[model samples]
Target: MPALRLLWLGCLGSLCRAYFDGPLQPEMSNGSLHHYFVPDGDYEENDDPERCQLLFRVSEPRRCGAAPGGLSLRQELTVLGRQVEDAGRVLESIGRSSSYDLDGEESYSQYLRREAAQIGDAYASSERALSELESKFRQGREPEPRDGARPGDACLGLLLRARALLR
Candidate 1:
């Protein structure tokens, strides 16, 4: 189970890198993109309230741009998709682990079921968000860059720490 989980995580990591780190397409270039970043009070200046809401929901309401991490909408969606995939793996691991039990406690099994359901809900939410963001990107809307670390920076650190611990 552990081996399978590790393999799944490795595949997911590679997929994320491939999807987000690919060469920038012509439509993704600076001039062709629409900026998500706006100075404070500048959101109101824009005519597209829906776009503002979609791009800025991941950010603090008061702030107009990406979080301190410079996470554009596309990158944020990718991170969210990665997180969903990870969570699905976790749920699958739990299910697989539970299946090995010859005489599992009913309460424990019930708990696992509930947890799996919750994870499913979360995964669905992440998928929906990713879909929405991708739709926006397909429409030529791009998240503006802001000052800070890149998206998934903390996740990378955590993954590295986990690898070290596993070793």
Candidate 2:
């Protein structure tokens, strides 16, 4: 049951395969704590992750661009939150599968159990950031911190990933 708890809390660490690689960073609202990120339009440069650059500081949630798609940063934030929730479901399965191991070695099932716990912690942190960012974004206010902290010009953050790209 503790494993279940861990799975519920983690942020799906490095091994957690991505179910989405699209433009996770969308433009945010004015005075937002996020930035607008888009493919540098230099796809011929190989569409490398480095190509995902900050386009501009986000505006109000209502006016933010959605980067490559029609989805605004606000909407995309919702999508990201849903994705995190979905990953938790997969982590839950992993925790359940751990029940099959009869081995006692740390490299065995117990190792997986630990991973599950770690991911749960990560997920919990991510969930908090997501929810907080979303709520503040909707209200068109500067994020407090740990999640909604304002950006470069005090208006950049993809709510989640745009911060990296914005850099």
lDDT of 2 by residue, 27-59 (tens): 453433333345444446555444564444433
Clashes of each: 0, 20
Task: List model 1 lDDT by residue over 33-151, tens digit each.
Answer: 33454446665677665545322112234356676768888898999999999999999998878766624546676767877888999999999999999998887766665678788
lDDT of each: 0.72, 0.64
Q: After TM-score superposition, what is the CA distance of residue 44 in candidate 1 from its true location, in Å?
A: 51
Worst 10 residues of 1 by lDDT: 53-62
Model 1: per-residue Cα lDDT at residue 160: 100
Query: Residue 68 of model 2: what lDDT?
Result: 66
How far off is residue 47 in model 2, in Å? 27
**Considering every candidate listed, which one attains the maximal lDDT?**
1
Candidate with best TM-score: 1
lDDT of 2: 0.64
